[model samples]
Target: MVAVIAGPDEMVGRSLPFSELSDCPYVVLLGEPGSGKSTVFETAAKAASRSVTIARALRVSGGQHVESPLFVDALDEDRSEGSKKDKIFQLRDKMLSSSLECWRISCRVEDWRGAADLSALQAATTGAPIVVTQLQNLSVREQAKILTSRGALDPEGFIGQARRHGAASFLECPSSDKMGVLT
Candidate 1:
């Protein structure tokens, strides 16, 4: 369905179908910058009526607030070349151990050189399921390349690992479904 952007001078835009959402519990939203990536996430959260904490993708340094069902907005600024994959791995470790139910992680495709490190990380960490959209710039092939170069042993093993981790990637009741009904 066509979705309207809520900003002051924003225009209407097309949207993905809810049914297209991943069947798995966790979701990672992958997309290029300015591809309405964040909007997609906000829309999903609004539709599900779930509360989401948006954060920049980075190591939990001093003041970064980590929340469940988190939307990692943008990581384009992260130029940690060799450490990039490692950082993602560490982040996944922390997330897996958290008590959050569902998480939607959005990262710019160009940031990781078109990699799905976020997805791999989520799979490793929480075993909670995740959904991802493509960043506008990179192609799926490029994303696959990045995932491979990073030494992700089981690229598509997120779902199984999530099951083993026992972390419910997504909240049973999406926030969209929780909106108060009108009388």
Candidate 2:
């Protein structure tokens, strides 16, 4: 998958492969619901050559010095009985106390209020740049590629039918269908 990354110094959106973000010390991945945020995080974690720490945001705690890559998934999936903002603050505090050199966090676009929520993580970085990346919708070509790889006999025909029926938007997001068929 690809994402549009905006760095601290540069607000201009630049699309890059998710794997290219390895150098970033801190990253916040924003995407719509069911936009494959967890899928992307899991893929990256699996592809990591070295040891990578993975955790859910709600279970994250401090005192562990993780110098390797860290992947925290599903910030919006917290089921704790408190405001999300409070959870964010608590998460920030935990991050602040931890010795994390590189970390990537994923949250739904709607729940990520703005830069204010990331103040604590930014502070924790201690001069390392914090990058925010938003996952983009899959292009028609990419969708077609996925369909073809999934054994679709006529990928273009399926896309054409979807477009004609005004259901093309669904093709932009990944689904959990085992057959990989659009239907």
Candidate 3:
């Protein structure tokens, strides 16, 4: 059931059903790069209404406790992308062994999982090959929100980058209440 198909630099974003999104003990958000996966994580953090602890996948090593809801970004990627899978497995073991509220991890769609999927598909097609490309650009409102969040999060850097990138159009977008992030 294709509900909304996109045109041009757009895509039909998908996720686990809302029930699973809200109820799952752990969830992974996978997408093409710049597909607003970070925004989804932030929105989920807001909805969870718990102490949010975020860590980059590289920094997720060591004796991390389960004191609060944790969101680890880019679990399937790192400078040592291949070696990091061991760490991910270890983290999973740790999470299962610990008491926790909830947790999530995000990764690029072209990372390990996508690589494996593509490889299998290509082999099945007699090595004709397959390629994955960017799926969508942020909507006007989402762009504005991202701009605001970026500025708030990194005022100096965002100012320079926004000007250089000619992102002034993002300023014209209307704001959304966006209260349904959880739902």
Candidate 4:
């Protein structure tokens, strides 16, 4: 997956492989609804030698016993009626009280409240810089690769048809629903 550090100039920033972000102590991954944020979060959790859910991590007391990052996905999936700011502040308090050293949180770009949310989370950290990154749409080559891997009988033909139908953008971010239509 490709990503870039999110900021005012992010559109022109250089992109990097998502794997390179593991070294960051705090990361807030923002992506469109079907941009694979949850997939990436799950992949990281599986790849990490040691990892825990943020909820479980928060339950651990006595400070930083867990030596790995805590992974939190679907930050925007909360069904609570509370305001976003309230949720962020509650998460901040939990992180501070638990004294967790590392975290990776994923949320839909539309749901993210920008710097305010980042600032709240940053306050819980031990001065480690918080790096916010946004997931990028899949390049055409990447989309083709996925199609090939999935045993598409005619990946190029499908791509052409999608383009003709003005649905090519869906190819860049294939969610389950979108994939159903494409495949």
Candidate 5:
């Protein structure tokens, strides 16, 4: 179906519509910076009816006024430096709480603390079968470069491993995915 979405100037420019999300239990969007997380909500909101309520994470922290399903931009600049871990746990708790019908969160994989937070979020969400999407960066080459620089990846070794496994490599690639911190 062809979906209609309102532009940025509209009231629903960056929030999802209630009808579009009523069936979804909860979702967590995972990716790096500038990965179009806001766009997803914006598109969903365009088709929604007017008067749907939405709020960001900062406002939620100050006073728990926003109702579910809440759309939280976890990568927003307003997040405090020292309170990231706490914020994540709070979000997790809120998302999983009985009061919330649904919730959505976005975070960058490159954020070291967020990386840890994702694991905890993943663990909690798994029981509820939440949808998770990894939005690939616009520049795949740059994405590879970031991984290499982080020492989380070794390009040469990856390519060599890929060659060894032939077409089946990705089926078992990024070996790190299977390795623990101590491994």
Candidate 6:
């Protein structure tokens, strides 16, 4: 049976049925260089502007717990692009594994060399709102593999695998949101 499509007002911008965004503790940002991943983060932050405290994990038992607002900007400038990727991934894993109470995350990957592997990890992981973007070109199949392999969203078969992933993924453009837009 075919169901009727609803309007945004009816659904309130919800595009997925099994959505768990309300309770999501984290948001994973993924994309290739110049894909506007940063822009999206800024836009989403602006959309849900609020200062919520978040806890950071510690290695030692009974260790000091760090707290900060829900906003997390893990982008790095001094380090090499590859190092930056590692930093984000490490932070992501830590946040996911710990009992931290974080609401939003903002990450950017300007390097595509390690994008596929990282994206796959993000998609497969549960309990978070993940956004992956890329400015580089890879076959649609490659993109699909990364998303599905990580368990983000699934397409029916091989054909479905040849598409994009995330709540939204797009090419970079001048219209992209600025960091201040979120502030």
Clashes of each: 30, 0, 0, 0, 0, 9
Report the C-alpha lDDT of model 6 over 49-137, residue by residue, as the tens digit: 64422212221223334342244443432124443334445544554454456534433454322444346436324544343222233
Better of 4 and 6 by lDDT: 4
Ranking of candidates on lDDT, top first: 2, 4, 1, 5, 3, 6
TM-score of 1: 0.46
Task: Name the best candidate (by TM-score).
Answer: 2
TM-score of 2: 0.80
User: Candidate 4 — what's its lDDT?
Assistant: 0.69
What residue runs in model 4 are displaced by over 4 Å at the alpha carbon?
7-12, 49-67, 79-85, 174-183
Look at candidate 6 and tell me the lDDT of residue 88. 46
lDDT of 1 by residue, 21-89 (tens): 534355555544455566667776777665444343334644444555455554444434444444555
Candidate 6: clashing pairs of residues: 30-132, 30-133, 31-133, 32-133, 32-134, 123-150, 123-152, 124-150, 124-151
Q: Name every residue pair that clashes in candidate 2.
A: none
Q: After TM-score superposition, what is the CA distance of residue 42 in candidate 4 from its true location, in Å?
A: 1.1
Q: Which is better, 3 or 4, measured by TM-score?
A: 4
- Model 4 Cα lDDT, one tens digit per residue, 126-165: 8977777888877777777778777888888888889999
lDDT of 3 by residue, 1-183 (tens): 011121112223441222234543444455555445555566667776743344343245466556445665665455244553445445555554555445666666556455443333232222222222222343444444555664556544544565588854333222122322211
Worst 10 residues of 4 by lDDT: 54-63
The weakest ten consecutive residues by lDDT in model 2 span: 50-59
lDDT of prediction 1: 0.45
Superposed on all Cα atoms, model 3 deviates from the true structure by an RMSD in Å of: 11.2
Worst 10 residues of 1 by lDDT: 174-183
Provide the overall lDDT of each model, using Cα atoms, as 2-decimal numbers: 0.45, 0.70, 0.44, 0.69, 0.45, 0.37
